[model samples]
Target: MAYVLQSDQRGIRTLTLDRPEQRNALSDALVTEVDAALEGAGADPDVRAVQLTHTGTTFCAGADLRNPPDPHALVALMRRIVALDKPVVARVTGHVRAGGLGLLASCDISAGGPGSTFALTEARIGVAPAVISLPLLPRLDRAAAARYFLTGEKFGPEEAARIGLLTLAGEDVDTALAPVLDGLRRGSPQGLAESKRLVTATVLAAFDRDGDDLVERSARLFASADAREGMTAFLERRDAAWVW
Candidate 1:
């Protein structure tokens, strides 16, 4: 079966992640399929917006270790998401964790069900959430988001939406998604394209100017004695000391 299922409705192409048994883990082929779908949506003149959703209860559980995701591939996918020609909305139904949460953050609009959960879970698995941080950082309340990043706890949707991780959170996902799509319909396609380009360019410009600074910031954490301790504790099934 195809890993990705796509359909276009009212100029909005919604891509459904089809791997319910694995909670939609991004295996190599899954990522490739997703990227290809995104590319197709971008090229189709009839597709003015896209919605990324999953078939099962969870939006995604992140990448599976059995078919670990390559950093390069993930970077390319996210870059495309951020640079897509049209607006993309992430329709999350249940838990969205780790790198999957990164996908939510990169999209232009995000709508999810009530009581859904979210987490930056890499800290619990002896890894880092660096992949999603670029897109997530801007959306979070600096001090509050730090708590989850350091401790890796699953937080309530209320808190997630309150802290800006979720743009819409109430009722079933479809309820919220309907209005977002309706609103997008009134927007000028050319205007959306120009606006998206300007916004993406602004963010990219800042990152480009601070490329060295980002490297420095990341290097410091990787070299930190505390980060090593945290990863080791996670791997050893011990409690992390930095719980916030």
Candidate 2:
């Protein structure tokens, strides 16, 4: 079954994460499909905008620990979204966690509903949000990043927006996103490409410089005994040994 679904309408390409059964977790296959779709959208001249949305109550439940994605591939996918010539907007109406927030931060704009909750939950699983930090660190306020990254606390849409993790939060996120999508559709392709470049230059540089190191760091953590026990505990619906 396809994990990601693709469709185009009125010059906008929409990529929907379709793995609702898994809460649209970023499994290795799903990550590959999403990256490929973004690349295809960038190359297609008829596509002016891209919408990254998901179907389900949970936007994404972070990585699929059983079949985790390669750290290098995940970082490359985030960079692809950041560097894509056309504007990418995320329509978030559900919960997001860990690497899912990386996907949101990589987008040009993200709008979420009040139902949307977010958390940097990697620490709870005995790993740092290393690969995701490439996009998230730049978008999030320093203090907010430190707090959430360390605590693994869940926050709502209002706090997400306040912390710069979301561009906007509203009662109806899709309705709130319409105007922004309309504005993007009106922008000339060249103008959008150059403007995005201007805004993302720093992120691109960070990706180039630190991407490999972060990938290695993530792999090391995932392979650790702590992560194994934490993930096992989570799957078994029990507390990890360290949890008191």
Model 2 TM-score is 0.98
- Which regions of candidate 2 deviate over 4 angstroms? none
Pick by TM-score: which candidate is best? 2
lDDT of 1 by residue, 1-244 (tens): 6999999888889899999998887788888899999999999988879999998877888776567566557666777888887998988877887878877888888877874788787766555777567677777899877898987788877788889888888788788788889887777889899888876775455444553554455456546777677656755788777655
Off by over 4 Å in 1: 206-244
Q: Superposing all C-alpha atoms, what RMSD in Å does each candidate have to the true structure?
A: 3.6, 0.8
Per-residue CA lDDT of model 2 for 193-244, tens digit only, reads 9999999999999999999999999989999999999899889999889997
User: Which numbered prediction scores highest in lDDT against the true structure?
Assistant: 2
> Clashing residue pairs, candidate 2?
none
Error at 117, model 2, angstroms? 0.6
